[model samples]
Target: MLVKTFRGAFVCTALGLALGVLYGGWTALGVVAILAVLEISLSFDNAVVNAGVLKKMNAFWQRIFLTAGVLIAVFGMRLAFPVVIVAITARLNPYDAVHLALTDKDRYQQLVTDAHPAIAAFGGMFLLMIFLDFIFEERDVQWLRRIEQPLARLGKVDMLSVCIALVVLLVTSFTFATHAHQEGGVHADKGQTVLVAGIAGLITYMIVGGLSGFFEDRLDDEEEREQEAEEAAARTGRSRSAVVLAGRAAFFMFLYLEVLDASFSFDGVIGAFAITNDIVLMALGLGIGAVYVRSLTVYLVRQGTLDDYVYLEHGAHYAIGALAVILMVTIQYEINEVITGLVGVVLIGWSFWSSVRRNQALTAAEPDSEAAARVSVP
Candidate 1:
């Protein structure tokens, strides 16, 4: 289990060490260790949600996530993403941005930091939608039943989650604007930035989510899919409809996962600045942590942990809601990263323990002792 679950983690640690050794020797290694821990703590909820999405994907796409997807997650999102943000915000070309990262590290960090409002708006809104969607879903088992059931009922309203997200955003923007005005500050630009970034996030969620849901609907009718598969087998001597639809579903699912991962990374990237502006060191450490998260995701998927611990997803969505609120709050006042991490950890841990208790009750109530013994402890 260790080898299977943690192969990616091992590879990432080795690579992190090599990168540290080449960059700053033993001191760099220590920095790498710190950053990795920071990322893992910040993004544990992300791993749980990732597993939920990954379970829908086919084996080929799953492998791609572990391989090519890792490159994209680490290099594309962690390293290049910061550079690209700096480039766009600072109005410098990508090459110049790289030079700035290496040479004028302070300037690069400041550029990224300055762009935090928009980034926060976009990421916070996107993640907020994830939580709202989950809470609004009709589920058989409820982790926070009293809170969730009402929200699920509220979900019947058209575009309810979007409406709620927009309302929260507008309220926050006004608070920021009012605070800015009292301090003799400008309001139009800040409010506009918030609105625009939020709309962009909403559009992104719509597009990716729409495509994913479309494919999912197509693949969900088991009878229809099997019949189509059989018809294709008889006519073309190849049962391809189910396979094709399933692959299409997995493709959209993969895209959604990557975008979701990016949204979750926004706060982490910004928080890393609090530690160091050395982009390479930050990437090395965070990259290692990301690999472990991905490994944990795979472990959850393969072990069917989500099925066993039904409320795990509930915990993750709750954490996401908290993170979204924290992101928006950071737009006005500085929030401690430790506080943010602790809230998510606490929510998830509590939910996990809740799941354990529920499992114990169900196991005890089972008529067959052998059947109870067969149940896995997630």
Candidate 2:
């Protein structure tokens, strides 16, 4: 497993270097490396969150996620999405945008910066919602239950969070975003576009995510109810019912995991646009990030990391919340990618360390279980 993990990283590094050499040699290498590290650091929380969903997926889907999903992430969203965004926002033809980027690198960079605020806002709110939902929602943990019981019962105030973020974004976009305008007549109609884009992104995420959560909760309930039915039927002689129900439960779990993956990817796709306008660079950076994230998911699943580290999910969720706020701020204020990466790394690192400590404590408490079983065995 260790070898496999290292091999994947090596493959990505080689691909990056090759791309760099083909593009601009040493300059491109520096760009890819810097972007790779920045993306990896900023997206560790994504790995943590992904672990939670990936646990429920079957091996086949997991493989697909690693392979096809990387293509979507690295190339589709990273490279193509930025081009798409510029085409839509700037009213430029897609081919024209591509031509501009390839020929006039400086102009292309400027266009990318102009397009960032909306992208940032979209990602920011998406992440914020993840955090708020996680923090406020009920968990299986006894301690978390005690702390979040009131908030969980009251339900997530997502609308309120969106409203506040919008108000702030509008204020900042009016003031700071105007100041940031440069030589090109790329004056974004900050008022209407910011509100529409931010709200649209927020609403789209909420609808999809909320529907996904609703179905998931219903599935959980159905599983429990079916199990009870199976138990009751077992008293008579209906073994077949239990097997059928179990199969249904498994299918439901698969659907749930896919929806969850989509939710997690929403912010990541938008966030990719914030770094570079060069579709190639964006794809390379985000693709590398996706590879590591998927690898980490596989690691987490095989090792049962989430089951072991009780608070790791919580920490990741908190980081998600922070990312949301940062995204919102970026609607008006241009956040440095390096800072974003550092924040994510710090949060995830803290969670990892905490989980390790908890696992050690758990091991210490169960010190004699292995020995006890060994001594009793023939």
The local distance difference test score of each candidate is 0.86, 0.66
User: What's the TM-score of each model vs. the native?
Assistant: 0.91, 0.77
| Model 2: per-residue Cα lDDT over 1-378, one tens digit each | 866755786799788768877987777676676667666666678778877876766676677667766766666656766677667766789899888777886667666666766666566555666666666665666234566687676556645555655676566557645544432356446655565666766686677666656656766777788889888888998773433333444444444444344434444544554544455765676667667776887788878888887778877877777776777666665666667667767776787787788779778878688789889999
Which tens-of-lDDT digit does each residue in 260-286 have in candidate 1? 989988888888988889989988998
**Model 1 ranges with Cα > 4 A deviation:** 177-188, 227-242, 368-378
**Clash pairs, model 1 backbone:** none
Worst 10 residues of 2 by lDDT: 240-249
Best-fitting candidate, scored by TM-score: 1
lDDT of 1: 0.86
* Residue ranges of candidate 2 with Cα displaced over 4 Å: 5-9, 142-188, 221-277, 362-378
Q: Residue 279 CA error for candidate 2 (Å)?
A: 3.3
